[model samples]
Structures are given as structure tokens and as C-alpha cells.
Target chain A: MAAFIIANGAAAMGDDVTMFFTFWGLNALRKPENIKVKKSFLQGMFGKMMPRGADKLGISKMNFGGMGAAMMKTVMKQQNVTTLPELIQTAKEQDIKMIACTMSMDVMGIREEELIDGLEFAGVATYLGEADEANVNLFI
Target chain B: MAAFIIANGAAAMGDDVTMFFTFWGLNALRKPENIKVKKSFLQGMFGKMMPRGADKLGISKMNFGGMGAAMMKTVMKQQNVTTLPELIQTAKEQDIKMIACTMSMDVMGIREEELIDGLEFAGVATYLGEADEANVNLFI
Candidate 1:
């Protein structure tokens, strides 16, 4: 949620924004109904235990069995702020670059078709190359 | 560790940086030997179970009984990268603004003395004020 907010804000300000999603971060890009994955026993457990997508994700701290997430959503709504999904859509509309890490996808058994469309795929080198020239690079 | 790495890297590159420590994030600023807190039972449990300071912090993912943190430290050493504590100290030396959220400290019953020196205290308003003027604002 924070990533999408920042990305949208930066993109709105005309900054060239790139969100490199890797590991669990890729969960945000997963289609809500198509989040199934095949992996080792423990890895599969991890996948099953995790929230399906951005809408279901709990906040990192003070998340009282998902209550905190719900409260946050309510607060955002009350404040007339865009929802996480809306922020993501806004980011897409603003043409912010979204890169999915190929290595992580392979290890996690996530296929391209399972993710939302209009995203590029690359490895660490690609991210480093972009970070090298960028003035502001963040990992949220 | 990720936060410190990014902070130190940005500061080294002559970027003005501000890290707002809130809730669990304040744990990283706690002085390892003096981390005692007087909160509600559950909050105290949360405080006690968490790592004491930057050195004791575990990674967000793949933290297998602290092994992942140890391995990460080892890798940093092998790569001639600064440890988390060292990176934090570097951030301090580079004059990166470190703000401990007053609201979080109050809720957690964390005394200001328990945190490292040479830091400031503020609320969200101050952070927003800084972020409003800055070209690069990130939450980690």
C-alpha cells in the first residue's frame, strides 16, 4: 500500500518511477483469484499462509488479526484517499514502470499469466542498472 | 538493515535523509542493554519478543530462528559492507535526521533515554512537512 502510494505520488509529480517487485513483494501484483502456486512443502505453506493479493494484505505492524488493515482502509476511505487498488491503477495510468523479478518468480512458481498485465520482467542486474542512474531509489 | 543500508548509501551520496521511527521501528533505535518498557501486558510481550536494537534485528523474510540475520551479517562482512549498527552510526555522522515518533513511544511506554542520542522527536505532521518539501520521500 505504501509503495503504491509513493509510486503514485512520485509519478504524479512527473518523476520517472520504477517499482521493482521481488520475492513477497510480487504478491501485490498477483491476480486475486489466480494466486495459486506450486512449490516445496514449506514454500507452499508460506504461500498459502500469505495474503492472496494487495486487497487482502495486512499491515506490517499493529495488525490485530487483519483488523488494523480494515481500519486503515476505512480511514483512507473516510479521508477521501484512493484505495490501494485504485492507487495501483493510478500508477499504471501514469505509466510508472513496474518490473517483476524473474528469478523470484521462478523460485516461487509464479507464472506471467498469474500476474496483472502491462508489467516487464527482469533480474537484479536490470534493477541495479536503473538504480545506478537514478537519484532516488527506494525499497518499500 | 535494509533501511540503514539505504539511509547510509543516500547520505554518503550527499542526499539529505530523514528516517521516521514509529511503533516497531523504534526498536531499532533502542539501546540494546536498556530496552525495558512498561506497557500493557500484550504490548510488553510485543516489546520483549522483538529484537533489542539494530544489531539484534532480524530480516523481514526468511528469518529462520535468527539464522537469516546471522547469514546476512556474514554476507555483509564478506562483501566489505558495513554492519547494520555501523551503517546506523554512519547515518548519524552524515547528519541524517532520525525522528522517533512521540505517539508510538507513548503507546509503547518507551522512554526517550532508551533510544540513542542525537535524534529528534516529532509526530506525523513534522514528517509530512519534511516530505512535502523534499523531492524524495520514502517510507520503509
Candidate 2:
């Protein structure tokens, strides 16, 4: 579903969008970088790990806050808006190509040498090159 | 910042983009129709009443989420990406013309007849007219 929104949005602008997922979103591509665990002291003490990977990081369409996102979801459910997870899954199923950022890996002690397979690395040039062709671009 | 991004992005595609915010993002607009309380059970049950308009509903880029928001934020911050709030504020400060989404406003029981001053309202046709001429039309 995340892919679907991204791919569709990028496609809507008719531009080539290259998502450079550093940290966790890179999980989808198995890029060498893993997101730093911003552990709460409590969670850290308990050794409770957060969800990992791009697969887990790509959020849904509804925003979270205030009523803690329930309002958006309630309205969406009432209005029949698609769920974020569904959109991410749909994007993947639709074959949206994603790229992982390499710089973040090096910054976070993630080893491109040890990154998961099925992923490739490209630097700012790669992102800029693609952005040059993109009519629209978004970080999230 | 939003205007800079939008102008640059739209111009990148040689398109004129109209950024219309409804719900929470509209808070910057100062329209009468956009004064709502984003109350929860406690707030709703105990706080004073507020408008359920666009300003309160629009979200800031720094802390937005749908599904896998946590990882996305970490990656974005690490990547040095700017948040949407900054983008919107930049747009406002830079004099970028922003339109509020009237459909969303009305659905939220907003009084379009009483929207904050300086805002223009038309249907999707308004956006469509601009979008039609635009080589790239964007939702963000």
C-alpha cells in the first residue's frame, strides 16, 4: 500500500521518483542500512525491539495525533478511505521500484557490505538525477 | 517552504500547482471556518467547544503517520528531509498562494459561508482548471 501511494503519486506527476529509504524504510530493499533503534529508556531496559524494515515502516494514509489518529481513521472508515497498510501492499504488488539511501547506512553504522540482498546503493547523484526528472517529490 | 517546494516542483514539471489544505494544515490560514477543537474523549467530555474546521485537521509534516510512520520519520530525519510544517510555514512566509479544500471543510460541518478571510473556494473544478493546464498536478 505504501508503494501504491508513492508510485501512484509519482506517476500522477509523471515523474521518475526514486525513493532513497535510509534507516528503516530501506528494509524493503534489503539495503545494508538498518534504522537506529530510538529506544525509550524503559523499552531499552526491557530489551523490547520496535518493528523493523521498510515493510514495517511504511505507514498508512491516515495521520496519527490529537485523538491519536482515531479521528482520521474514523472519518476514513466512515468515508471509505483506503487503509495505509493496504496501500503499501498494493504498491508492492503493483511492482513499484524503490531505492535505498547509502549515506544513511554509513552514518548509522549500517554496512553496505552487510546489507540484505536484493538491494542496490546510489548516492545523492542518483537521487538528484531522478529528482531532476521528477515533477513531484516527497521525503515520506 | 511549501511554496518553495511546490513552486520548484511545479516549475520542474512546467506546471502551475495549487496547494489546497483542509483539516489541520489549514491552521495557518486564519479562516473563520477553520477553528476546531481536536478533542479526544477527555477533551470532548470536558473542554470548551471548538470548530471542526480545516485549520485544526491539517497535519504538520514533522509528526505525521499512517501505518509504519515510526521508521519513516527516523529515516527522513536522518536523511535531512524537511518536515511538512516547515514547508507550509515557508510557503506562507514566502507569499505562496494556498487554497483550502472546501469539500473537506464542508464535510466537517464547516461554514464555507464563514471561512476565514482571504481564502477562495470553488469545487474540484477550480483545482481541475489549474490542473488541466498543469503538466503536473500534485496532491501534497
Candidate 3:
């Protein structure tokens, strides 16, 4: 959510932005029904237990059985603030470059088709190239 | 470590930076000997389990009983990369403003004296006030 918000804000300010999604971060871009992975028995359990999509993601702290996430969503709606999905949509609309880590995808058993449309697939070297030229590089 | 590295990098590039230390983040600023907290049984247990200082912090992923953290630290040293403590010290030297959330401090039972010197105390409103005027705002 923080990454999406910051990317949206930066893009809104006319700055070029690229979001490099790696490892668990790629889960945000996964299609709800396509969010399953089974690298190992433990990892499969983690995948099943964790939230599926961006909207379903819970807060890192004080997430009481997803109640905190629900409450936060409600508050965001009330405050007219964009939710994670909406922010992601805005990011796409704003033409912010989205790249999924190919190596991470391979390790996590995530296929390109399972992710949302209009994303580039790249590796860490690609990310390093971008970050090398970026004035503000963030790893969220 | 990502936060500190980015902050240090930004500061090196001459960008004005302010790090808002809130919730679990305040742990990085804690003096190793003064990291104890007894607010509640649960909170105290958390304090006991968590790393005491910046140098002791474990990796977010694959942190096998702090083995990952120690290994990473060793690799960082070999690569001549700045360690977390060194990064924090660099942040101080670079004059990056470090703000501790007063409300978080109260909740976590962290006192001002327990934190490193040269820090400001503020709440969310204060963070917002600075973020409002800044061209780039990150919540890490």
C-alpha cells in the first residue's frame, strides 16, 4: 500500500516512477484466483494462510485476524482515500512502470499469465540499472 | 536496513531527509542496554524476542533465529557495504532529521532517554506537516 501510494504520488508530481515487485511483493499484483503457490509444504501453507490480493492484505502490525485491515479499509473509504486496488489502478492509469522480478517469480512458482496485464518482467540487474539512474530509489 | 541505506544515499545526493520512527521502527533507535519494556506481558515478551539495537536487527525474511542477519552482516562487511549501525551513524552525520512518534513511544514504553541523541519528538500531525511540503515523502 505504501509503495502504491508513493508511486501514485510521485507519478502525479510528473516524476517518472517504476515499481519493482519482488518475492512476496508480487502477490499484490496477482489475480485473486491465481494467488496460489506451493514451493514447499511450509511455503504452501504460508501461501494459503496469507491474503490473496491487494485488497485482502492486512496491516503488518496490529492486524487482529484481519479486523484491522477491514477497519482501515472502512476508514479509507469514509475519508475518500483510495484503497490499495484503487491506488494500483491509478498507478497503471498514470503510466507508472511496473516490473515483476523474473527470478522471484521462478522461485515462487508464479507465472506471467497469473499477474495483471501491462507489466514488464525483469531481473535484479534490470532493477539495478533503473535504480542506478533514478534520483529516488526505494525498496518497499 | 533498506530505510537507512536509502536515507544515507539520499543524504549523500544532498536531498533533505526526515525519517519518522514509529511503532516497531523505534527499536532501531533504542540503546542496546535500554531496550527492555514491561508495558504488558505480551509487550514485554515482544521486547525480549526482538533485536535490541540496529546492529542486532534480523532480516525480515528467512531470518532463521538471527542466523540470516549474522550472515548478511558478514557478507556486508566483506562487500564493504555499510552496516545498519554505521548507516545510522552516517544518517546522524549527514544531519537527516530523525523524528520519533511520541504516541508510539508511549505505547511501546520507550523513553526519550533510551533513544540515541539528536532526535526530535512529534506525532502524526507533525509528520504530515513536513510531508505536505516535501517533494518526496516515504513511509518506510
Question: Which regions of candidate 3 fall more than 4 Å away from where they truly are?
Answer: A1-17, A20-140, B35-46
Order candidates by TM-score, high to low: 1, 3, 2
Docking quality level of the chain pair in candidate 3: incorrect
TM-score of chain A of each: 0.90, 0.50, 0.89
Model 1 scores what on Cα lDDT? 0.77
* Top of the candidates by TM-score: 1
- What TM-score does candidate 1 get on C-alpha atoms? 0.56
TM per candidate: 0.56, 0.47, 0.56
**lDDT on C-alpha atoms for all candidate structures:** 0.77, 0.48, 0.77
Estimate, for each residue in A103-124, the C-alpha lDDT of model 2 and write its tens digit.
Answer: 8655544445444444557777
lDDT of 1 by residue, B70-119 (tens): 89889989999888788888888899999998756655557788888988
TM-score between predicted and true chain B, model 3: 0.90
Pick the winner on lDDT between candidates 1 and 2: 1
Task: Look at candidate 1 and tell me the lDDT of residue A60.
Answer: 81
Give the lDDT of residue B133 in candidate 1: 68
Report the lDDT tens digits of candidate 3 across residue range A1-140. 99898899999999999998976788888778854443554334345544567876778777897799889889999999999889989999999999998755654456787788899998655665577677787767
> Between prediction 1 and prediction 2, which has the larger DockQ?
1
Backbone collision count in every prediction? 0, 30, 0
